[model samples]
Target: FGKENPLKANEWVRTFGATAGDPEGARLNLWAPAEARSAGGKSEIGYWGMELGRMLVESEQMPVCLINGAVGGTRIDQHQRNVADPEDVRTIYGRLLWRVRAAGLTHGIRAILWHQGENDQGADGPTGGFGYETYEKYFVSLAGDWKRDYPNVQRYYAFQIWPKSCAMGVNGSDNRLRDVQRRLPRLFSNLTVIATLGVKPPGGCHFPAAGYAQFAGYLHPLMRQQLYGHARTASEFPGLQRAYFVSQRRDEVVLEFDQPMQWSDSLMNQFFLAGQSGLVQSGAVEGNRVILKLREPAAGTSITYLDSARWNPENLLIGVNGLAALTFCDVPIDEQ
Candidate 1:
């Protein structure tokens, strides 16, 4: 409970089948940013509360409390009170969820989304500061606390403290923080830390409103696709060889298989064009599919697959058949 707009809870009615009220039998509490929580004042939750709300509505998932307890200058240490069980909580700072099972809030609270540490980035000690060893213990300690109370609860999605302006890895804060953050998934079977590694904007520790919106943009559409996209078998999302955003009209964005691509891991939202002017996002789906609609000629334009981070200079998707399905140029098929 740090300060300002603690939470902004709401109930997003499922669009299709479910009439009004909580869809799929879940009573998502939609915890609004703590400051706005006139009902409950717990604002130090972190922007994740806001982010989670956006994802729920965007992903069009079940009901959610979507609480926001972020304080302007708060750190992870502040979440101790939120821990579902006070007796179970054990961090020096004390930031965590109260054992809802013990407090008697809801029967099945799926999981908790913890995100913090912008403030503690510089605090010195064990795990790079909290004693590298202790840093590791904090995670187990926090999870153990929760597991003990909510016995059935397991899935956890915590943030690996964002890139710090504190020291950028010199004192090993960034590195150690990351090391500690990455260990969660390994330490706990149901735990996962959504990688914000390359997702952060330039000089931004937390995404601004615009940045936040874009992040939310994907959840809804992707969730909708998931309805039709979820595979019935183990081989649902097969590996595809290419990904990118098309930038030109008629730019044939062909996804060549690393090995024939019978199917893909997911209908890749791939398409990106990078050339003399760096890179830009591709446009909508076309006839059979949509390649980024090019407003300009592709004569000199260079198209890249996926994000700038996704690169294959050799175009491995090309295969022994050579750059067969590859579309390196925006050239029109000429019939002389």
Candidate 2:
């Protein structure tokens, strides 16, 4: 079995056979074998797969089987098969399909979990400092390919990439990548960007065991509400909807959000306004909106939450569901 012309589905099944099926009931394969170490280890020490499986069994009375297919240090391009060369079995995407076919789960895929993009943001990355537009194109193409192959797959969830820190000072382009990931949901309705706010990666870009466990905790409730049609039991996470200049107070700007925010002294500190002079100034949170005091006028000023440029450990803006406000910026005040 090699990267190129790897084993086919039938061949894999004939050799390894189906990974022992879940005797409890049905199974939900949790793919991502490549990055298993990052999510814990072979036993899934701190992987979210364990948490997901347990939640499904206890809360929803559903049996699940996690099938991992992730490979470490791989870029999105590696996981994608060439649309023109669909028959090529060299790509990781082709290999993943083989695994799915071997498991006889061509139609059992509930959701696809993606936690990648670090490699793409590397200094000498394949894309060479890929921007948001380019990243969007590649991702959309990948999602389209996956859907074309597995029509039964319901939703696709991706993690916003971890940023550069003192421990791992490799790629400084992570913020750009994170921005691209944050806006992916707008482009693809079926995709959900799992918020990685408040998650502190240990050293390097990978989250430690505890961090992985915490990520699972964040994901469980979301899946419970989104996939199972259960009502949100926790506080909602605040997200920006739009921003505009106050007609009466031209120097002031109002920011609207999708959900209400739990305002606090610390939370208000996370909000910032920027203009040509840089870091304009922030005001107060009045009801479900935030007011920004522009240095001069609302001409070229923009408001951002959690300073989308760098990793700030102190940034905290809790939303409705006990989740932190997403990293956002570049909200034009003139736009309604």
Candidate 3:
């Protein structure tokens, strides 16, 4: 197996060196739903990770090791539950999430790979389990909660239910299942749904073997698309939405966005400050927009934001951008 190992080390540095690495690639962690570890045996889940990892090397990007977080026979609600779900390994997503949070690497999360729904397709008729509304409720909440949790994790949900290959009309004739798939992404800002309808629908519709992972050819490419899209969206981070009042009396700065934001370092990839004399000072984000106290008290400073179609947390303040001094946000782009 002589592969070029096509990507050279410094090439990444030379090309993307200007930008801050998303919290050191090698050290950044991934959390997903692999089955619970038993005393001596592995869960019956498939081995699609190796295939995924191999394809990644082909992409000219560094090979990233993924942490398995999926479990067997679990459904969608399982992944979104904030409370620990004992049916599947409890608090797994939460535990890894805490560490990622404590490490303060929100931006390090590029995307979440979700392959669920085998358990929910009881049927898809107007009266079937798929027709029920509970899945949608959980999905909508999950999107907001993930934003609330990581603030920087963009998700790519793979709707794993599908076009039944054998006996298409029976076992799991849930067309409504597909409808929900099409609908989930519209409710959240940073989510995308990978339509897996054409893939071989489970023959048993209840369980499938590890070789069933053949669908990765379709599923994995979609995963790549979503990950790249997340990066592009995040680069547009910290676009301000509103500036209610800038007072000269207390030298106070009061800002408001239709969406709420936390000032985390994840948001400050490479921020700068512009002084009145046309001199710009650069900064880093750990809490909020990095700013130096007005050296002259009245030196005066303003902020920056996207005047275009940026996700307006102002609409409801998506998540806080916890940052350090120097990075500033909510700089109102005049509404024209």
* Top candidate (lDDT): 2
Error of 2 at 267 (Å): 5.4
How do these models rank on TM-score, best leading?
2, 1, 3
Cα-based TM-score, every candidate: 0.46, 0.75, 0.44
Off by over 4 Å in 3: 1-46, 83-89, 95-106, 123-131, 163-173, 200-213, 223-226, 229-336
Candidate 1 segments whose C-alpha is farther than 4 A from its true place: 1-9, 13-48, 54-61, 68-103, 123-133, 165-170, 200-203, 214-336
Query: lDDT per residue, candidate 3, 1-336, as tens digits?
Result: 112222222211110011111223222243333221221112111344444544555663764534444544555565664554321223445534544454455567666666665565554433445533567776667666666665676665544344332223332233335445545545766555543332243333432333345444544555565664323222121223333223443132334432334443322222212223212232222233322222232333443321111212222112343211111232332211
lDDT string, candidate 2, 244-336, tens digits: 888654677777776665655445445555523343355666667766665565545566655434445655665655676666655556643
Worst 10-residue stretch by lDDT in candidate 1?
13-22
Candidate 3 lDDT: 0.39
**Per-residue lDDT for 335 in model 1?**
16
**What lDDT tens digits, residue by residue, belong to model 1 across residues 1-336?**
234444453445211110111222122223322222232233222343455455665555555443332344544444343344453334222212322322254345456556555555555543445433355565577667556655765356555544443333334344445545655555776654443333324224546544444343322333334332433322111123334333335343433333333222221333334433322233333222333334444454334333222333222222231211222222222211
lDDT of 2: 0.58
- The per-model lDDT (C-alpha) reads 0.38, 0.58, 0.39
